[model samples]
Target: MDIKSPLPFETSDKAHANLFNRMVNTLVENDNVLSQQIEGITNETLFILKGDQAIQDGSVSGEEYPIGITFMDIGQANDTGYPTRYGFVKNEKISNFRFVQYYYGTGNEAGNYFDSTGIWCRHWWTGSGWTDWHKLSGFLHTNIGTTGKQLLTKAEYQKVLFNRKIKDSHNNFDIKNNRFICPENGMYSVNAGVYIESFQRYANFELSIYLNGIRYKNIAHHRQRPESPSDTGILNTGLYGAANVPANKGDYLEIYIYANYEGDVSRYVSDKSGWFNYFDIMEIGGRNFPRV
Candidate 1:
């Protein structure tokens, strides 16, 4: 990328007026690229202008840089121009770089194993760095009951699997406390799955995310279904849902369920490790806006 000189302008004094006027002509240059024209001046009213916004791609001005596969920061340009760099975004402020791409890789001490989950990126402090794998919190598990005959009260709502089972990776969730306390303030993606089964009467349940003692995201609900009068326990239903929510530090995240039935109901639970149920949490971006 070719970076044009962003000359400093000074017009108050005769010595600085000539140099300032010459730099002003470059401001309106038709070259393509988003330009940040800021000059270091002692005056209170500082003028920082941007070039044409409708600039097209592949323009020489560097306005509207295209980011496809990967990108990185290299910092400010020099006097002659931008220095040659590889893979990274040249002649730009590293502070402005937003998205960071990541690739999936897996290996164990016993054997080398890898499966393609595709490339993913985050606007947060995420990257392809190996250590970033554990930086984000995520988990998966199911809410199964103790006895098949005792669950989902006929007229009442019951928290599935005794609040929530610690199935997948705990991440930021406190297994003992049975709640996910956010470690940072930002936007996050949450998902859940529920399984309902009835031995005799139809199955009925309501799943949701109870945040800060207040019911937040509603996942799934089974109103009424065919009942096995002979108590065969064959009728079953699966509920899955996902949603995005804004959260702040100290906010609590917990899975809740209200099951109602006549005979028996259970939502697939397991005491052993490695449950099929899934509950995932990912931080996307933070709240940042221009202060006008």
Candidate 2:
């Protein structure tokens, strides 16, 4: 009678193969059907979840979503939610033994990937849940504050890491200690710049990024010598230095600056223009946190 329209296959024996392939294709077309596809999948098995979900044709009307695990946008598109979180999980239980969250950065304000918001990632070797997670975060701050007018003594060195005012995302940078605590073990970019002025000619100044209380040698630092104009305009020098270095959790960095002047002294001028004596620190997200 009706032999199921002859089922597209070489022979009746290949009908099962055709059925299996069609089933997989269907599973790859609609994420809504993911549950049915993985009904017999094992824990260690990995599968692609593809498809055009909102549309239907028993075929991918848009994006082809494979089956097994799904990278659903539970939150707003592009993770622009009041705050976006990223981590891998299978159904709620931990997958790849991780679950990281950020408490800071609102709606794409961005905290350079991982931020201070009590950021914690699951640690399978230790345990699970909220109590058993690892702290991984990024920090940002500047060297601007209250105390002003510090004329460097000849050949005097100092940690010019802070002014009288401050803004710390996670308390990672200690104004009191003049140190930036490494929030996580990863590659970081340390940068420093100062708005300086030399009343007399031939003023030599140095600004640097120090890691773990030691001088960072990766970035070669040259002395800054502000030129004395023959006219009434005072000479102002913008000193900048940066370095890319690896740091372990709890390791720290500092901004050290010095001046060796034979005639007049060098000074940390005012931040009237918003670009005076500042420092920047950022974790290399592309290197530290690879896409999961």
Candidate 3:
């Protein structure tokens, strides 16, 4: 059988002829024709098998996975730009992509891991580098040392969870009745007259109560309060806003109310009663209150 040379033919030099002759002589002397054929067949078979396996595994050649990108800061860009030295995957489709920044630092100076704060991605290709691209500001992460705005207090959260109400002694008025009615879950109300001394500062506030641990399923907002005193009125409105509240049995309720306040009130209020004068609880359609 005639053996074909693996090396390309080059007429430029006599060294090529010497190398070809040496290869042919070696093949004949060693009787390597069958071995070479088997080796070639095995490699071809393996290549085909591996190619199928790679396709199944979502592997692509000349593709850069976003996981390979590294971020040095926590700053986020809104429809801004890409980070330095980061590029998109070539010849690939992307969806439901997001970028988030992780905060890492101790004291005054904190660094971010990436740009944006939530999952965001776009189908893109990078032949050279990330340039002249459009990226929306997804989310922003604050450094761990940066003071987070007050979200909610344990007691306030509990009050919303328990759906407690404040009653006026003079009228025996179930002030809880006057506040917002959590239609599906139950009713959660607080008196406008009560004050949490610890959270003295104020800003636009939003109260989110999870009934049965549904999570952000039901949220209430009370915007633009003046100070502690203003929060009282806002709380009252939040409780009695005529909105359908979340209700469920064996449900864990987590209430997160974001507010601009001065200090941490976690240690301040012990229970729902600390923030309100009259603490009462009642189901929206039910008459009796659970004995506590």
**Which candidate leads in TM-score?**
2
TM per candidate? 0.43, 0.49, 0.23
Candidate 3 per-residue lDDT, tens place, 206-261, comes to 44444444444334454444444532342322221123333432333333344344
Write candidate 2's Cα lDDT for 85-176 as tens digits: 43322222234344332222232436533251333333222243232223345344434343555555677667764644455554577768
| Model 1 regions lying over 4 Å from their true place | 1-154, 161-171, 264-275, 288-292
| Candidate 1, 1-292: lDDT as tens digits | 3456666565669777776767666654644234333333323222212234211121123323333332333222332121111112212223334533332212221331111111222332223211121222222222322223224455655444433434332245665655667654556677766555545556567778777877888877767656336356565656667777667657877777776655543444333221335455655544312237
lDDT of each: 0.45, 0.50, 0.32
Candidate 2's TM-score: 0.49
Question: Candidate 3: worst 10 consecutive residues by lDDT?
Answer: 139-148
Error of 3 at 194 (Å): 6.8
lDDT of 3: 0.32
**TM-score between model 1 and native:** 0.43
Residue pairs clashing in model 1 are 32-61, 33-61, 33-62, 33-63, 34-63, 141-277, 144-268, 144-269
Clashes of each: 8, 14, 25
Q: Name model 3 segments beyond 4 Å from true.
A: 1-194, 198-202, 216-220, 223-243, 246-248, 262-281, 284-292
